[model samples]
Target: MAKLQQTLDDVRSIELDNAFYVEDGTWIESLTVASNTEFDPETVLEEISGVSLFYSSKIPTASEELEIRRLTILANESYPFILSLILRQEAIPNRIVLQNDVFEIVATTRDWDQFRSMADEVQETLGEFELLSVTQNEEPGEPLDSGRLTEVLVSKLTSDQLEVLETAYNHGYFDVPRETSETDLADELDITQSTINERLRTAERTLLELIYGPRE
Candidate 1:
C-alpha cells in the first residue's frame, strides 16, 4: 500500500511545471512546445480521442512580429489518461489550450475515488508525459477563493445557459472582430437563432446580476 501511495504521488508530481489542478477536480494545464510549430486540427483529432478542435484563430500581440494562435479544444473523450478516469466515473472536460506540442487542458470530475483510480491507470499507461499534482476540492469544482456571491451566481445558471455562453465565447463571437456570428453558432449547435439568442441574453443577465445585483 505504501508503494502504491508513492507511485500515485510520483505520478501526481511528474509534470509539476506544466500541469495544475483545481479543487473542483478541474485541471488547467500548459503543454510545452517547440517554436514555429504548426498543427493540423484534423490530424490532432485523429491522434487524440478526448480532444476536439473547436476553433483556431491567430492574433498579433503588442509585438507585431509575434502572432499567437488561440485554439479552443473540447475534450469530450480523447486523452487516454483522462478518458480512463472519466470512464471510471462521471467527469467533464471544460477546456484545452494547445500550442505546438504542448496542450493545456481544463477538466472537471466530481468523483474522487474514480480520479484516484484513473491516476493509477495513468501511471501504468502513460510513459511519455508526467502528471504533476492532484488538488482535491473543498467543495468539488468550486474555486476556494470565490466569494459567496459568485457561487450563488454560478449556481443559478442552467446547463443550457452555460452551454450557450461557452459556445459563444469559444467561437469568438464575443471577440472584437467577431470570429463567428450568431447564425454560424446556431448552425453549429443545430439550434434555432432565436433559441441561441434567448440563452445568451439570459446568461448575460444572470452574470450582470452577479456583478451589479438585481435592478431596482
Candidate 2:
C-alpha cells in the first residue's frame, strides 16, 4: 500500500498502447508519452534511435478522413495517478509511471497464459518488468464508443426517437437488404408505417448532425 500511495502522488510515464504482433518477430504499436515537462512530438520521434513510427498523431485525433497528423504536441502532461481515477471504469491500468522512467502498457488479454506470454515479449523492448496489477473482464473485447453515443443520444434524440432508433439498429433496419423494415417496426410499436418512417428519418438526421455538426 505504501508503494501504491507513493505512485498515486506524482509520476511520469510512456505508454505503448494497443501493441500486437503483425508478423514474425515484428510488432505494430502506438506509443504515448507523458511527463511534467513539455516536449515536441516530432522532436521526440527524432530522439528515438531505431523504431519506425508507421504513423503518429496527438491525442484527440479526429477521423483520418477528416484530419491527418496534427502539428501540435501534447505538452505539460500531468497525467499520473489522477488520470487513473477519472478514466472509465472499464479501462485497466496497462502501465504505472515510476519516478520518471517506466512504461505501463495495458492491453486486452483474454487470459493469464496469454498475458504472461505478452509480458515476456514486451520485456524485451521495455527492458524488464514488475507485475503491478491485472484486470480481467468477462467480456474480452474493447468497450463501446460511449463518448460519441452519449453526446449525440442525450442531447439530440427524443425518448420515442431513441426507442425507435434502438429497435431499428438492433434489428438491422439499416442493413444492406434491410434486416427489418418500417412496416415491422410499425407493427411492433402498434403505429402506422408513415409515422415510423417519419420518426426514423428524423432520428437518422439527428445522428448525422452529430458527426458533421448541425446542418448549414
Candidate 3:
C-alpha cells in the first residue's frame, strides 16, 4: 500500500484540475491553490528528484495580496497523497483538494467497480475515508473525459454562440426559476432578442448532440 504524504504545507487549499499518467510512475498534474504564507510549491517540488515545472501563474486578490496560484507539474510522485492509487484507476478526477488536514477527492469512473476500488485504496492507505455521494451523470452511457470536455465543447460552439451561452450561464439563465430571459440576454450581449434566441438554440443543440450523441 502507498502512504499519504503531506506534500505541501502552509496551504489553505489545493484543487487538482487535471492529471494524467505519462509513463512509468510519472504523472502530469495541473492544480490551483490558495496560501496564507510565503510558500512556493515549486521549491518543494524541486526538492524531489524527478519533478519538472511546465507552467505557473500567480494571481493576487483585489488588494494585491498573493492569494491564489496555479501550477502544472510533471513528477514521479503524485503531489498530494491520493495519486498513489488514483493513478491506477484512470478515473477522471473531478476535484482533488486539501482543506485543513483532510483530502477530499471527487472523481468519475466508467463503472461501480472502478469507483469502489479507488475508495477501497483510499481507506487502506489514508486511514480515514468518507464516501460522500455517488450519482449517475445526466447523460447515461456517455462517458466524457475532463480533458476532452473543453476541447470538444470549444470546437463545436462558435465564439459568438459560446459567449452568449457563457453569459446566460453566468447570469443563471438556466436556473429552474429562469433567472434571466432572452430579452435580458439580448440586452447584456447588445444583440437583438431574436439573435439571442437563435444563438442559444443553436448552441444548445450542438452541446446536446455532443453529450447525448448525435440524433440518429
Please name the candidate that would achieve the greatest TM-score relative to the true structure. Answer: 3
Cα lDDT for residue 139, model 2?
Answer: 64
Predicted structure 3: lDDT: 0.68
lDDT tens digits, residue span 44-153, model 1: 44465444455554422222222233334444422454433434545554433333334334455566666665556655665444555566664544222122233355
Candidate 3 regions with alpha-carbon error over 4 angstroms: 1-26, 30-73, 76-79, 85-104, 108-132, 136-144, 212-216
Best model number under lDDT: 3
Instruction: State, as a TM-score between 0 and 1, how close model 3 is to the true structure.
Output: 0.52
Q: Total clashes, candidate 3?
A: 0
Clashing pairs in 3: none
Q: Give per-model TM-scores.
A: 0.34, 0.34, 0.52
Residue 131, candidate 1: alpha-carbon lDDT? 56
Over 1-216, each residue of candidate 2 has an lDDT whose tens digit, in order, gives 112213322324443333443444344544343333344445544444333445555433212211112222222222232222313233344432323444434445556776666666555544676777766667655422222334345457776776677677667998999988889989877889998889889988987887888877
The model with the greater lDDT, 1 or 2, is 1
